[model samples]
Target: MMTTMIRVVLPAHLRTLARVESEVRLDVPLDAEGRLTQRAILDALEARYPMLRGTIRDHVTQQRRSFLRFFACAEDLSLEPPDAPLPDAVASGAEPFFVVGAIAGG
Candidate 1:
């Protein structure tokens, strides 16, 4: 299995939950087509940090949590297809994938 190291920045709460102080570097595996996707990144993250398995996405439905958002290269990727390839900057490590916890108040 071929793999690439990806940089990911988690929200403060998640960072605390994962016990990581800085951005996380994960060895994400490529799919059968030799392409990396958001699903692959999230899968590798959960695999490496078991505690984050269901925190970012639903364990059963695999849907991103409503309170969470994903971004890369200054673009919002929260609604992007899971199989879609991330931006070249993100794939090449020029930018870090951001997992942000949304805040709402009135």
Candidate 2:
């Protein structure tokens, strides 16, 4: 299996939980078609940082947390399919995948 080095930027709380001072670097394996996706990245992330298991997504359902959003190349990927290919910039390590904490107000 081929692996790619992916950059993932976590929210402040998650960064603290993972004990990471800055963005995380994960070696993510590509699928059979040599495609990189969000699931692959998150899988590798959780594998390396076990403490973040349920913080980013639901452990059982594997769904993203309601307060979290995904962004890459200035695009919102939160509504995209997990298996969808990320932008080339993100895949090439030119940009970081951002896991941002959303804010809501009354």
Task: State candidate 1's TM-score.
Answer: 0.93
Question: Which candidate number would show the highest TM-score if scored against the true structure?
Answer: 2
Report how far residue 47 has shifted in candidate 2, in Å.
0.3
Q: Cα deviation of 44 in candidate 1 (Å)?
A: 0.2
Deviation in Å, model 1, residue 12 alpha carbon: 0.6
Extract clashing residue pairs from model 1: none
Residue-wise C-alpha lDDT for candidate 2, range 1-106, written one tens digit per residue: 9988889999988899999988998889988888889999999999999999999999999999998999999899999999998887887788999999988662
Residue 81 in candidate 1 has what lDDT?
Answer: 97
Clashing pairs in 2: none
The true-versus-predicted C-alpha distance at residue 106 of model 1, in Å, is 11
For every model in order, what is the number of clashing pairs?
A: 0, 0
Instruction: Give the Cα lDDT of each candidate.
Output: 0.90, 0.91
lDDT of 2: 0.91
**Tens digits of lDDT, candidate 1, 1-106:** 8887879999998899999988999888877877779999999899899999999999999999999999998899999999998886776777999999888762
Q: What is the TM-score of each predicted model, taking all chains together? A: 0.93, 0.95
RMSD of 1: 1.5
